[model samples]
Target: MYDINTKRLIKTFTDMAKISSPSWGENAMRGYIVNAVKKLGVTARQFRSGESYNLLLTVRGDTKRKPVLFSAHMDTVTPCDNVKPVVSQTKITSDGTTILGSDDKAAIAMFLEGLRYNKEIRMPHGPIEILISCAEEVGLRGIKEFDTSVLKARHAFVFDSDGPVGKIVLQAPYHSTMSIAVTGRAAHAGMEPEKGINAINVLSEIITLLPASRIDHETTVNVGTISGGRATNIVAEKAVCVLEARSIDYRKLRKQEVLIRSIAKETSARFKARCAISRTLEYSGFTIHPDAVISQIAATAMARIGIRHQFEVSGGGSDTNILNAAGISAVNLSAGMQRVHTTKEYVMIRDLIKGTKLVLSIIDIMR
Candidate 1:
């Protein structure tokens, strides 16, 4: 077992998890982190975006080596207000009404513990920057809108993936979000239903043609939300659907995107209605070799801590995508969080402590 202060990490996690820090409303959580850093005798700065604030803590004077950034988001999903963290002997969870907030808070706690340990040990290390961001759970808006120009870290480690302790995210996929609108002429359903075209039917045909589940090994499509038809007695005038497709291979992604666009236009023309389709490149995908600097650093850290180092692909998106897009080589590491974004969310205390030890080990290695 790795040497780490389990009590301190869990206490700090409990304190933060109990706070109400949903998506864009992270005022309380931000204050807690800022104050906690100050109490630890470290100064932190804030970067503002809309109603949320991102906290940045720098440790430069201690080490004269290259810089590395450790990032974790402070926000959680909905039903997180008034969280009650239940700490069992082996696990930590919520009271079943709200999320336990371990998705990112586990990272926050582990980072804090590692910082505290480093301070106590006075270990010689490289420049380290701690980034506690906001509004990540919603759509990765915090890191997306962030100004990385102020950061000098060449490598970043994101503590936001959900898995066991020793897993490293080797690659993430590129995502294309599509918003489509299907329009059809509206007429009274009882009187002239035959004269009107149904927008819902047009959209349904397009969806069938488009990929929904697993398209390939590295690609997947999902229809998150759709709305159409105001009343049963009337033909639908307009319908809208929000869908997204992600793929590790750019060629495959483009092909599927083209197919989706084709489906939209063809179905719209067949129904004699207008089809409006727009796609946004949400974030670029990245594939990091295991021998890369960041990956090597983490693998060495894991080996030093006597943990198995396994690199895997991530289907979900995180702040790692934003950092990589900003030209910083990075990988998302698991924080030992399980069943995130639900009332059933829980994390093993053993895994949490192991995760903390892993961060501490990475920091120690740079020293």
Candidate 2:
């Protein structure tokens, strides 16, 4: 069993929390992490990207088993710049002004601390690869830019989800974006109202006809926002709504899209409006068997760390979805961050320490 440095981990965690790293603005954070890893005498490299660079670090191990990969994103959500973290006696959080960004910075610190501890103690572990991705807060573009061929291991663990340390997410739903355009006649609202057709009315009718909220056992639809209006006096000539549909089952997702299209067409025909509906598959879903080797390894690792565990399914998607699609059986690990993507985001210090312990245990499990 390897012992992690509590004080060093806390100091690193606090230092990382202070950095303002939002999506597409991860350059500073990446540079800092790269330098930190280099100072530790590890091989660190940066992957070229449009906005932010992906930091990749490798730690060689004995020839006992295949390499194991650990992944976490480097970017936070909006309002992340100029963060002012407020730490109480038990936990660390941000002021009311911005988010705490525990969504991934906590994971990054834990990974780095784990590497430091492993190197210091000379833990007998397999080859380890640490991938710090960027722009994950914005539609997983960072993972999308990753080169799958560079991966030497088929088993990976992604530290990104919120909750207790033992929560393991093995499945996530596939997502798609739906854009509906409603066209109608433009006329004065007060005068010639009869001659004018309201696109808003068409939009409302379509929304009312579609199956929203919970679509089925594993499907959902949400009309996020709508726009397109000029003046109160004139009828709206055009309106558009950005909607999203998600499902764990591909066939079911396509069925849901068909239903949305049907509603659009029916409402448009009824209101004498021209409707154009377009949908793009944002990302595919992934399901890993609980009995697979990857799950077994993670379960063993968590158990070794004295943490109870269970497999879970997530409705949201992440880079794990992309990695699984790329043939690596990736599972999302919980890191104890709460209220993510909000100003109230926080992570218990105890849980963060336990998360670091879990990472070290995982290394031993893979050994």
Candidate 3:
């Protein structure tokens, strides 16, 4: 076991949080990490990207075993810029005016702290790689664009989950983003209301027919955003809704999609409104077998670090979905991020220390 520098970890976190990095605005964070790692005698390479960049750092460990990749997203959700991270007695948080940037910053600090501790203590381990991805908050964009074909690691751990430090998310639901467009005739609301088919009315019918909330324990639907209506005096000519559905079961997920499409077609026919529906598979769901080596390794590591091993299934998808799709087995590890993507986001100093220890334990588990 190695001791993590509590002060150094906090400094890295507050420094990175103050960078004000959003999805596309990750260059500053990347540059900071590159320089920070270089100062630790570790070389990092940044890949060229359009708005965001991906960084990779490789360090040869004591053995010839396969490398284990540790991943953390560089970007936080909106309202991240101008973040004022405040370190208190037990945790670090924001001033409530902006997000704390702890969604992944906590994990970023843990990764760096783990590296420094491992190097100082001369921990016996295999090769190690750290992947700092950008634009993950937007839609896992960085990992999507990253060339996984160039990666040599066979196993990966994504430290971006919420909850305690030992939570291992082995499963997540498949996600589909949908756009519903309705076109109807415009007319005077008071005068020729009968002549116009109100698109808003049609949209309302569609919404009523679809599941507006959780369909089941593992399934859900949400009409996240809606826009329509030109003015209060006239009947709306067009209405649109952006929605998403997710489910862990493939059959249930497909059935939900079919039901939504059927409702759109039926409602459009009944109201004489033109309806256009488009759906994109955002990410496929993944479930790792509990008996797999990765899961066993994480369990052992957590136990070694004196943290309770908790296996969980996330209702939301993550970079682990992309990694599993790309043939790299991975799990999402909780980095003690609480209330992420919100103004209440915060990370505990205790969990940060524990998380860093867990990472080091996982590395030693391999040896």
Candidate 4:
């Protein structure tokens, strides 16, 4: 069993929480992480990706052992400016007005502390790579744009899930995003109401024909945004709706996609309006069985740290999905984050220490 410096871990986490790292604006956070790792005598490479940079740190270890990668995002959701972490004896939270930014920061702090401990004791381990991504909250944009060819590790462990430290995400859904536009003739509402076709009405009818929210235990759909209208006194000539669908099963996801497109086409035609829809596959779904090597390593690491490991399926996507798509087997481990992406987000101090120990344990097992 490895010993974790609890005080140092807490300080590191709180310091990161104070940095404002909203999506596409993670320069400050990246700099801070680079400096922190440098203090441990480890140099990190910053790759320019989109509006931000992706930081990668490689540590040489036993060459005979397989290389392993660890990942976390540097960006946080909105309302993260001027974040003030309220650290108590039990947990760390925000000032009730802004998010605590622990969604992925907790994992970062854990990684840093684990490195410090490993260096101090010169623990036996294999080659380790840490990838800190930017703009992950926006849509996994940073990782999606990242050049995976530079990585030498084929197995990765992502620490970005929200739950206790022992929970392991075994499955994530395939995601597809859609943008639908309805076009119709416009006319004055009072002067020639019958001469116009309201695009808003046609779009509303199409939405009613679609399934939303929870489609089943493994699938979900949500209409996130809608806009279009010139004036209240005029019939709307154009309207647009943006939404997404996700499912663990690819066939089910395609079925939902086809159904949505068909309904939008049929409904718009019935209203004599033109419907244009664009759909993009954001990321493919992934599943890692319990018997897989990556899963076994995670399980063994948790067992070594006395953490009761549990398998879970997430409705959301993370860097893990993208890594798996790149042919690198990966699993997302819970970072003890609670109520993430909100002002109520918090993480337990105990879980933070446990998470750090888990990281160290995995590295030791890789030797």
* Cα-based TM-score, every candidate: 0.95, 0.95, 0.94, 0.96
Query: Candidate 2 lDDT, tens digit per residue, 231-319?
Result: 89989989999899999999999999998899899889989999999998888998888998888888999888788998999999988
Task: Quote the lDDT for 149 in model 2.
Answer: 83
Worst 10 residues of 2 by lDDT: 1-10
List model 4 lDDT by residue over 1-367, tens digit each: 7877899999999999999999989999999988888867676999988978999998888889999899999999979999999999899999999999998999999999999999999998889999999999988999999999999999899999998899999999999999889998899999999999999999999998898999999999999999998999999999999999999999999999999999999999999999999999999999999999999999999997799999999998999999999999999999999999889999999899999999999999984
**Per-residue C-alpha lDDT of model 3 across residues 17-37, encoded as one tens digit per residue:** 899888888888888888877
lDDT of 3 at 271: 97
In model 1, how many backbone clashes occur?
A: 0
Model number with the top TM-score: 4
> For model 3, which pairs clash?
none
| Regions more than 4 Å wrong, model 3 | 39-41, 188-191
Q: Is candidate 2 or candidate 3 better by TM-score?
A: 2
Off by over 4 Å in 2: none
- Using lDDT, give the best candidate's number: 4
